[model samples]
Target chain A: MPRHAPIELEKFVPYQLSIVSNTVSEDIAREYRERFDLGTTEWRVMAVLARYDGDGLSARAVARLTAMDKVAISRALARLVANGRVLRRTHRGDKRRSVLRLSAEGWRIHDVVAPLARQHERAFLERLDADEQRALARILDKLLATDAAVR
Target chain B: MPRHAPIELEKFVPYQLSIVSNTVSEDIAREYRERFDLGTTEWRVMAVLARYDGDGLSARAVARLTAMDKVAISRALARLVANGRVLRRTHRGDKRRSVLRLSAEGWRIHDVVAPLARQHERAFLERLDADEQRALARILDKLLATDAAVR
Candidate 1:
C-alpha cells in the first residue's frame, strides 16, 4: 500500500489496552482456574452472586449485569450448580423462573478468591501512584461512556 | 458467606477495564468480520504485517508482537495465506525458518481497514476530554510497564 503514514502498532491505544487486559486476565484466571477450577465466566457468576446477600438474582439479571448473553449465563449457571457452588432456587413471585444464590461452598470460594482478587488489584495498582490511580479511574469512566451510550 | 466486606463487582477496576476491552474488541471485530471475513487473530496478523515495509517478520516474532501463542500465530498465518492476503517465504539466511509478509491483496485490505480502526479509536476517545485522554495513555503506560518487566 502506498501509505502517507503507517499506523504505529506499538503506540495504538486499543492494542495497548487489549494487551494489558489480556495479561491481567490471564494472571487472575490462572489463580482461580487452578485452585477452584473456575473459568472466567464461572468466576464472574460467582462474584455476582457473592455480592448480593438475600434472595438471589435471576439468570436474566445475572446476564444483564455481567454483559453475557442468556445462553452463556445458562451454561455457567449449570456449571456452578453442578459444582455445588451456587443454588438455583424457585423465584419467590415468578414460579417459572429461578433465582440464583451462592451455596455454602460458593461462599467459601468467593471469600477466598475475593481477597486474592483484591491482592492482585493492589499489586497491579502499585505500579502507579495515587495521582495516577485517580487519573486512571477518571479516564476509564470517560472511555466507558461511549460503551454505555451505545448499549 | 459471612463476610467482612464483599467485593463489589461493579466497582472493581479490572472488571470495568475488561468490559471496556471486550466491548471495544467486539465493536471492531464486527466491522472486519462482516466486511473482510477476517477473524480477530487473522486481522491482527494482517495488521502486523502491514506495519512493516520490507522483508517481513518471522512467525516467532509475530507471536511475540501479537501476544498470541505460536500455534495461534501458525493458524492465523495459514488462514491468511489461504485467503491470498499473505505470503510465507523461506528465510534467506535460515532455511528452517519462514518469514511472512502481506501480499498485494493484503495491503489492499490493510489500507481499507486501517482507517476503520482509527475511526473506532477516535470515536471511542471522543467520549473523553484531552486531559482524560492523556491520563488514559499515561495509565496504560504504567500498567504495561509491569507486563513488560515480567516478560
Candidate 2:
C-alpha cells in the first residue's frame, strides 16, 4: 500500500494568499485601531464613502463590491453617519435608493489615514523589488478584473 | 480654493490584492470553521506545525510569520497541543527550544483540507489564461522578491 503523503498548506495558493493578505491587512488594521480608535470595518466604510461617485451604492452594490453583507453595511453606515465621516442622502432618481458619500472630516482623516496605509504597504511589500511590485500589480489586477473560477 | 478629490480604494494595489485574497480566504475559512471550530490563529498554527522545519519556532517566530501576537500564538499552540494535532519534541542542541511538528492525523487533515483550497485558487485564477496567469505569477513573484519600492 502506498503511504499517504503529508499536506503542506503553503502549497495551496488560496491559503498562501490569505496568509499574505491577512498578515499585511492585520498590520494596517492594528495601526489604525491604535492611532485613531477606528474599527477596521468602520475605516473601510469611510474609505469607500470617501471615493463614492454618482448617487452611490444601492446597498446591494456595496455588499457585492466590499464582500460585506448588506446588514453590516447598513449598520456601518449608521455609525458613519453619526460620526460625521459619511453622509447618507436620498437618491433623487431612485427614491428607494440612498447615496453614501464622505464628509469633509472623512476626507481629512482619509488623507492622513491613506498615506499611513501606503507607508505600511511599502513596508509590507519590502519583501519584493520594484519589478516585482509591477508583476504583483499585474497579477492582482488580472485576478480582480476577471471572473474567478474555482475548478 | 482647491477642491478635494475623493480617492478610490480600488486604485490602491494593496487594497485590490486584499479584496481578491480575502474573498477566497473567507470562503475557505468558512469551510474550516464549519467542519472544525477553528479560528484563523488555530488554523495557522496547524499549518505551521504541519510544515515544521529544523529552525523551530519559540511561539515568537510563529507570531511574526503569521502576523499573530505571541499571546495569540501561545493560546493557539496550547489548543493545538490539547487537540493532539501537534507534538512538541525537544531540540537536541537547545533545551529551550521545543520543536513543533504535526501528528499523523494532523497531516491527514491537511491533505484533506488543501484540495478545496487549491480548487478555490484555480477558480479564482481561472479568469486569466496561461499568459495572464504567467504574467500574474511573474508579477507576484517580483513583488514578493523585491518589496515594491523599485517601481
Which candidate number has the best lDDT?
A: 1
Which runs in model 2 stand beyond 4 Å of their true positions? A1-12, A23-37, A53-65, A88-101, A110-138, A148-151, B53-67, B88-99, B122-126, B145-151
Model 2, B57-127: lDDT tens digits are 66766776665688998898888878887777777887877777777766677666656556667776776
**What value does the lDDT take at residue B13 in candidate 1?**
81
Residue lDDT tens for model 2, A100-121: 7777777788777877887887
Q: What is the TM-score of each candidate against the true structure?
A: 0.94, 0.69
DockQ, candidate no. 2: 0.37
Chain A only, candidate 2, TM-score: 0.80
lDDT of 1 by residue, B1-151 (tens): 4553577876778887888888887898899999999999898888888776567899998888787899999998899999999999999879978889888898889888888888888887878888888888888887787679988
Tens digit per residue, CA lDDT, model 1, A49-133: 8776567889888888787898999999999999999999897778989889999999889889989989998888888999999
Superposing every Cα of model 2 onto the true structure, what RMSD results? 5.0
